[model samples]
Target: MTRMNYQSARFLTSAPTLAQCPPDDGAEVAFAGRSNAGKSSAINTLTRQKALARTSRTPGRTQLINFFTLGDDTRRRLVDLPGYGYAKVPEAVKREWQRHLADYLRGRRALRGLVLVMDVRHPLTEFDQTLLGWADDQDMPVHILLTKADKLKSGAAKSALQQVRSRLREWEDLVTVQLFSSLKREGVDEACARLDAWLADPEPA
Candidate 1:
């Protein structure tokens, strides 16, 4: 595959449930985070597009699992998973999405790695740790983006970064953490480097 031109990313499809997702036969990296965590903003910044991934004030506005192909190639994709947090949706629907999200995380063969976005101010939540555990179960590598770094002072952001690292020390070999600011376009290259390595891998298993 040619090197990913993230700028070329465009929406490919959206699936309401795992069963509706695109064919499970290619390399993809999924971005997931809690509500209002700036996952969409990080994606937009990374792709150099203002609205490549929808940004909303309302959390979980789109419960669909959105997929975007790199440079029009379906084999390489970026997935925007539904954000976790307070939503106006029904409990049953939330539960259903959770089931499928877990199923996808645990079994999706095409997934190369996971990009777990999080608010730098609130590094790891209970749900975040739960997702990390799932990643661990499948031996999937995770690169966490502590988004909204711009919200903190230079020294404060670094401190938060260190705290997250310290907490995740046990999973150091499998998880990588970094401070990110979609507003400042910071850490884009570092995140890209990790994504490139994962998406370009010849064999996933």
Candidate 2:
């Protein structure tokens, strides 16, 4: 498996332009989810860095595609997609954001897989389903990370995981589901393992 260790964030850029993305190297694994999904915290936790991916107190702070290189000089790009579902953003701007997000999701040829982070308390939502549908249409591999698992009791967390699994299993398209707790440092290795496995696999034709 390809070992993943966050080296540093090279730069942060908008999605419509990919203004900060590194030149094409191998493949990019993107993190996509709603605002306040604990994405930044989870990313920092996974990388074992306290403040690698900036955690925003306000939702929708990340308005673009933020790129971070992992490992050494020969590093893979970790794309942090802008958070969706914030009602405060203007409609016109939201649509424009969607346009950029859609363009990336629809056109990025080197996209290997997606890390779909959902709040464990809420699991999946309508918007989440739409994103999953889009990924299914593209035949992209998706790994769902149920974030904030530590907030729940052990039994509750297990039950939620099963519930999410059953719901995903019902879908015609497949997805891998895992629990994560960035605050408690739980499941970080598991998340990394999934990423490693994908990185080690042969590229799709």
Candidate 3:
């Protein structure tokens, strides 16, 4: 198996709905989180690009499934799923987004794993648990990033990580949790290692 060159990533396409997504022929790991959870920032940081994934002041600006290629290969992809649970979004629209997210998670064969981002100070909101339930139904492996770790004191951050891990102990086999700070660039290497494992070609390369 070969590890991908994440820094070589470039914008591939964006699909307003899952049906419009690119051909599902190769491994892809998706980043998902609620609005303002630092998902886009993490993606940008991971790819070592200032704007690989757009960081917006508006929390729910990402309304599409954004796709990016690993290096020059279209087969290896990184997906930025729509940000969910924005309070200002209309309820009907929120439901529609949830439907599309559910459809993709349940049906996307190319999806290898999910990187679930949440603010360290507010990890595992209601929608986050809902997302986790969907992942459990699909038997999808998840790596939980307690992002914005720098906002809390060092001891507080570690405690938050421990709490998240403890809360997810039942899912230990399919879920993992770690502290991450996009601001401090902390845990970038560890996160990339998980991505490497998930994005690596399963068959002989």
Best-matching candidate per TM-score: 3
lDDT of 2 by residue, 61-131 (tens): 67878777655533466788888886487888877777777777777776788899999999788878878
Per-residue lDDT of model 1, residues 1-205, tens digit only: 3456899999999998778899998799999998788999999999999999999888888788999998867888999999886678888987877887898898789999999999999878988999999999999999999999999999999999999999999999999999999889899999998888888853545
Evaluate all candidate structures by whole-model CA lDDT and list the values in order: 0.90, 0.77, 0.90
Candidate 3 weakest lDDT stretch, 10 residues: 196-205
Q: Which ranges in model 2 have alpha carbons more than 4 Å from their true place?
A: 7-15, 18-22, 201-204
Clash counts for the predictions, in order:
0, 0, 0
Q: Report the poorest 10 consecutive residues by lDDT, candidate 2.
A: 11-20
Q: Itemize residue pairs with steric clashes in candidate 3.
A: none
lDDT of 3 by residue, 1-205 (tens): 4556789999999998878999877889999998889999999988989999988888987889999998788888999999999747889999988999999999899999999999999999999998899999999999999999999999999999999999999889999999998899999988999999987873322
What is the TM-score of candidate 3? 0.96
